[model samples]
Target: MDYYDTIILEYHNTILDWVIADKTTPIENLSVLDKGISDHSVITLEKQKPVKRTIACRNLKGLDDRNFASDIKKEAKNIKQLDTGAMLGAFNSNLRAILDNHAHLRTRTVTHRPSAPRMNEQIKEAKQERRKAERTWRKSGLMVHRDIFKTCTFKVKKN
Candidate 1:
């Protein structure tokens, strides 16, 4: 009927079965009423449950392909070493759940945000400049920041 009606409909479309994602979030927190009714009057919240994501390895924090391969190997070995099928299945499912967190680390990365206007043109230009500087630094064997050397895929030439 009104703007509130459309908003409630949109929410209903995404959240089927009236399930709240966060368990700690109380329904009463949303006490704001429009006119005399609520914006979420149509939303029937059943229960809120928190989501927890587990990472594969905490010790290995590098982007090198070797690290990824090793981490995967370590995880696989751990899974293989499990005595029971149920233990293996549980570990395997947990591994699959955190698939998004796993990534192949690239050598080139933007260290800082562009201090200029955040539009497409400015962002592109800034990225280009940063990349160029990194390339030059790599070729010339000149380190930009000493601490950044600790990151993935960086090898230092012993002088």
Candidate 2:
């Protein structure tokens, strides 16, 4: 008996690219596999380089901690007194101060790194690996055994 045999390959190349890029921006080319033969057909794939973006750092200084704390306290008092507008204004001022302080502390100069491919490359590699595994299973007659294991059941006795 003659049976039609076919193989379908699908993959996302970003994951592999991310792995190769070391989880950094501007990922680079990722070479995973070469030409290979399967039970049905051969497969070939390549990963492209990733793109980088520029991130800017804004300077924030002159934030007074004492003033921030006083504002917070005043806002709390206003809130207790049911002065909604005043409380909201004070709360906004305090929040702005805190954010400014944090920005000042965390500020850093922007740096550009070489671009590399994103996560899609890695996904494609994974899919190719899966296809290879399936082909290997078919060649080794292991798929049938795996199915048997899936349907297996064992009776247990209570002690």
Q: Pick the candidate with the highest lDDT.
A: 2
TM-score for candidate 1, residues paired by index: 0.21
Candidate 2 C-alpha error for residue 124, in Å: 11
Each candidate's TM vs. the true structure?
0.21, 0.23
lDDT per residue, candidate 2, 58-142, as tens digits?
Answer: 4445556676677666655655435778767767776766666545435444555544443355555655555555566567788
Error of 2 at 155 (Å): 42
Once fitted onto the true fold, the runs of candidate 1 whose alpha carbons sit more than 4 angstroms away are 1-6, 10-119, 145-159
Candidate 1, 60-89: lDDT as tens digits: 344466655666676766664446887778
